[model samples]
Each structure stands twice: as structure tokens, then as C-alpha cells.
Target: MNLESPKITLEKSATEAFNFLSDVQNFKKLMPENISKFEVLGEDKFLFALKGMPEIILKKKEVTPYSKIVLGAAGGKLDFSLIGNISEIETNQSTVQLTFEGDFNPMMSMMIKGPIGKFIETLVTNMKTAI
Candidate 1:
């Protein structure tokens, strides 16, 4: 598996941050135009159709106030599990740190290498604007 960590700083409170983060469906609006068919499931799960691929499921594994959240998604085509996590949330003078990490399968790693990276960047950018 390949792991990468990307962090984003947000100018928002913990609760406000959670509120914005918890709304899973907004991903369609936040992600790039290549993304489509976004569907939200319950509090922390979502399924979306990424261009050129079948639908993928993202399930929230955990969540903690002013702390962290972990989401995982994987399929047989992948050599390993793919897990994305947001952790080490801490408030600065007027900003909060939203740290993102991804663990990907060796075979499919390169396929998502750039898009996933961009996805995280957009995730933070949207979070900043949402909150």
C-alpha cells in the first residue's frame, strides 16, 4: 500500500467544521466536474461514480469531535484496502487543521495517485469555503 498525508487549515470552529464535514452529498458540488452520480448514504457513507470506473463506496469508519474521522473503500480489483482518514484536528488562532491520509492498494495506487491528491485538495478547499 502507498500512503500519503495532506493537511488543510480551516478558519472555523470544531462544531461548525463537523457540521460541514458530515454533509456527505455536497461532494458532487465540491469535487471536480469529472465526478458524477454522487449519492449519500446515512450519516457518514457515500457512493459516487468516478469517471471511467464503477461506483465506489466510502464508509465512515469513525468520527470524533474536534478530533478525527476515518473513511474506507475498496474492491476486489484493488490489491489492498483503500482507507482515507482525517485526523489531528486542532484549532489555531483562527484556523483548524484538517489532516487527510490515504492508504491505497499497490496495483491501483498510480491510477488514483493524482486524482486522489486533487480530491483531497478540493475537499479542503470546499471545507474552507463551506464553513
Candidate 2:
């Protein structure tokens, strides 16, 4: 699997950052407005269907105190837990790193190619407001 790890540094409180980043429901708001839809599967899980995108279901595989939230995403046909993953958070320095992991198929790569940067920028922009 090709892993794409993206990092961001923010000026915010630990509790604020953790709460904002941990809630999957806030992702659509935190994300760029270009994103069309986000569905929270549970407290730490979500299924996102981007505009002109394939559906992806994910779960928060791990979480730690103000430090991290790791998510695993996959197609329904696959093992579900082993397909794709995203990890992010910060306990110090007000910095955060979000990493995307999984087997990179052509479609996923294409989607990533077009908008990952904007997504990150808007994510930081919007989530910062949550602080």
C-alpha cells in the first residue's frame, strides 16, 4: 500500500484540538466546502461519499489522549479493516500530522491528486476556528 502522510501545525489547546479532530461529524465542516457529503458511522467511524468519488467507510482504529486518532478505511468487499487508514493528532507543540494509508488504486490516486492540498488547507482553516 502507498501511504500518504500529511502534517499540519496549529496554534491551539490540546483539548480543543483533540475534540475537534476526533469528531468525524465535524469533518465535512472542517474540510473544504468542496466536499459534498460526510456520514458519521459512529462516534469514531464515518462513511464519506465525495462528489464524483467512490464511497469509503472508515473506523477509528485507535485513539490516545490528545495525541492521536487512527482510522481504517476500506471497501465493503475487502476485509474492511485493512484497506485504507488515516492517522492524526498532537499532544505537544500544537502541531498535527494526518497520514493516509492503504493500497492506492488508480481511482483513489486520481482523487487524491486533484484535491488533497486544498482539503488540508481548508481543514486547518476550519478546524482552527473550533479552538
Q: Would you estimate the TM-scores of all the predictions?
A: 0.69, 0.67
- What tens digits encode model 1's per-residue C-alpha lDDT throughout 25-84? 655565656776788876677877768867877766666664555566634343322333
Q: Weakest 10 consecutive residues, lDDT, candidate 1?
A: 76-85
Q: Candidate 1, clashing residue pairs?
A: none
- Name the lDDT value of residue 100 in candidate 2: 46
How does candidate 2 score on lDDT?
A: 0.58
Among all windows of 10 consecutive residues in model 2, the one with the lowest summed lDDT is 78-87
Error of 2 at 23 (Å): 2.0
Model 2: per-residue Cα lDDT over 1-131, one tens digit each: 34333455556656667777677776767655556767887887887765776677877777776666666764474332321122333344376555544455777667664465454445555654655
Please give the CA lDDT of all the candidate structures: 0.57, 0.58
